[model samples]
Target: MGKLSFNRLKRYVNPEVFDFDTTEEIPPLEGIIGQDRAKKAMEFGIKIKQKGYNIFITGITGTGKTSFASSYIKKIARTEERPNDWVYVYNFEKPAQPIAIELPAGMGKQFKKDMEDFVEQLQRDIPKAFESDSYDMQKSEIIKKYQEKKSELMEELNTLAKSFGFVLKDTRTGIISIPVIEGRQISQEEFQQLDEETRKEIEKRAAEFEVKALQIWKEIQSIDKQARDEIKNLDNNIGLFAVGHLIEDLKGRYKVNESVLKYLESVKKDILENIGKRVNKLEEKVLEYFKRDIYLVDVEGERVGVVNGLAVINLGDYEFGKPSRITVTTYPGEEGVVNIERESKMSGRIHDKGVMILTGYLGSKFAKDFPLTLSARVVFEQSYEGVEGDSASSTELYALLSSLAEVSIKQGIAVTGSVNQFGEVQPVGGVTHKIEGFYKVCKEKGLTGEQGVIIPHQNVNNLVLTEEVIEAVKGGLFHIYSVKTIEEGIEILTGKSFEEIYDKVYRKLKYYYGLLSNKKEDKGDK
Candidate 1:
């Protein structure tokens, strides 16, 4: 077969032909670039807003799946009137089960702030109102009235004791009375001198005084109850004065949402109940960091056993495209293919499978009759995280084949696509983001029109690129080459026929096998 023309092999993109200074000149893309099909499905998902219609955005990660869905939902969310505010509140009936109060669109923030302001105002106002002289004076009047009633009860007890012919006296221990001769207490000796009838009469009178003392204590307890009830009433009146209008104003703001209104009412009561208790600690808010791109496009020269591979990486709460160099080295051994990532336990099952398939492709092409005697090791450079997917399979195979054929791969071109055992290029996810990623790296390194990406032809359908990429492609400052088979990719990379390169690889494998055979024969002789 003829070699792929140099023109068809590398597409050119001139980023400067556009009338813009930098990418900042282009407006930010509104919706997903190449997913018109997903748009319809996503629109349906966003519009329904019903239960059980939840959209599961499943594609490969870093295909802009999460970002696209979020932006699209937000775009559709702006126009339609949906009350989507929610607040977690203490449920009085079930304190452990908090209630989420839903309010109007954009009203959750307002409600939160309003509630905070109300609490802060109460915090400042309630203490001051209780501390005021007027409140203290009213509280003292209640105490004074209680004390007057207590004094009257004590006076009644004294009068009752006098009627019993004993003088009553007040002491810290309790009320007491003594037998008196006229206005004075009788001496102990004189009391004994009295006849038995007189002593018995005195003891009975003392018993009557004790009963009167118990009645006075009961009356004092009644006054204490009245005083406590009166103070509580005063507190309620002051609390209403300080906080009632504040709550009413909040109610008016959230009148559109009955759920929010109900929540606010409950909150008002809770605030009153929890007054004087310091507020609970505020919850911590998470702040997201901006992650910039970290790959550089090599737009000049050529290197053997090196091919650019695209991958997805997650940083904090966001995902982005990362381009890594996959390198391969081959030797004559029975180990077949040694995957460094697999040995280090940094590759996923799918990635391990891809590496295994690389050995299969080599076996089919180079050693059909006898065992494949070559061993190869493949590694993704600077990769520490667990790598998955067969997306980089084709890229890695290119690097291996280049090493075997001793042909240099063009450094300017980055590549992505999966490969089957038949060496057929398969479509991968994030085709668009992968393109943009290499494009940015190339642009940052100083765009060379010769730089481009080789992608699977089947993935062309999934391409939805940004305006800058389109402009660069149109202007011939950048390029995107779509290939169908590994043979076709090989022809483009080496600028030679697929048969010519494979023949070289085949000969090299045979030469190694021939040496192994000779060494075995010499050993038998020895």
Candidate 2:
């Protein structure tokens, strides 16, 4: 075939574009499925912070790191109690960190101060009540005068009773004694004994005095009631006014401590300075971490070397890159596989190395019963030196399964999706980059007709394949298959239809139209 000049080359037609209304609701961060491990990690970090430990979450963009972290933090903030509260700092990706401040559970300082003042006023007033010279003395004087007036009225009733001819009795019958005159003179001893009439006369006088005293007592009680009522009203008015003044005074006194203010000022300065220092330290740490032969692409999309002598990459523009050294540093060999029989538990180390490894080994018959052994070692093959993203989680699952099943996955086809223990395939992030990365490799290798990528069906909408990749696919040089479950993915990756591979389970992979499965189930039942 004759080579065509650049000027004579035919231009490709672009797809006709029209905007369509998308009423589809974007799922909340919690609704995201198949990221239980990542979500749990974020939750743990939040718990650590709640226990007063600062945390830093590291993950590639679109891995839901920020969303998960923020949501978890917000949950903690909503439930916990503290003197001061948490603040969310977003836009850390920008110059100014956008922040949301949350107040604590109880009343503010001003209100607390007012309460304290109210108690203090009560304490002071209670003591003054006992002190005779205090404001209560006015009420006491009124009481004393009422008592004196009542005594004088009782004295007048006694005089009136002497003039009356009857004596009053103390019993409820209200009986009175009347005088009786007897005409006999007796001896001194007999006279001393006195006549019944004289005695009766004296009893009658006593009864009259009791009646007069009772009437005067009733009158005194009426005056006393009026005086007591007036005093009570005065006391109430004073109390109300005092309480109001105390509240206002306490509020006025509730100034932020000057020393605390100064200390906070210093703290703010130190925090900013410390943040800067940490930024520098983090830069150095990241640089050192990646120093061992990694090929990182700079912000301009140019390949750059990472080594001890090279300047540290700026965090602002640094993207994911693969490690330069293709070293299988995790497990040495078959000896590296975990002994399941020896320990029924999976170590934290294994748990951190992606859930796929644990599931794959546990699921396989070869590794199932006898120490269900498996190595925690895994990495992206030929992924020389760039930051790895979660987009490769599915690939990790496939590789892990291949290891467990002793089945070699074709390196010609790349896979990208998350997987659960039930062997269900789930959606992942960066569908575009992952596909393009494989596409780049395939193009360099002279794409065989069989070469293709297996991606989750949910990610199909995100397929904005580059022109070159599209051309290759159309030309039958490459292909792409969308699978909803792990069974479908395996079929796609192995170039065997589900029916041909696992005939019995093939029906399970059939798509159910118009039915939505619970996404929570896909998130490891979290």
Please write out the lDDT profile of model 1 over residues 399-437, one tens digit for every residue: 999988889998778899988888988777777767887
**TM-score: model 2 vs. ground truth:** 0.29
As for model 1, its CA RMSD to the true structure in angstroms is 42.8
lDDT of each: 0.74, 0.45
TM-score of each: 0.45, 0.29
Q: Estimate the TM-score for candidate 1.
A: 0.45
lDDT of 2 by residue, 1-526 (tens): 9988986787764445524334354446571256777666666766664555766666567867677667766778779865554333333335385544343544345444544565677667633442324444564465455544544553354345435643221111222222322422122355347778865665566565666567766786676676656555545444444344544454354334343233233433332333222223333333333343233312111111110001111222221212121111222123442322113322222223334443453345233223332244543322312222234345555544443333434545556665545556556555665566555444543567776667778678867778988998999988888887766776555545544544321221121110123343566676
Error of 1 at 397 (Å): 0.7
Q: After superposition, how far is residue 57 of candidate 2 from its true place, in Å?
A: 80
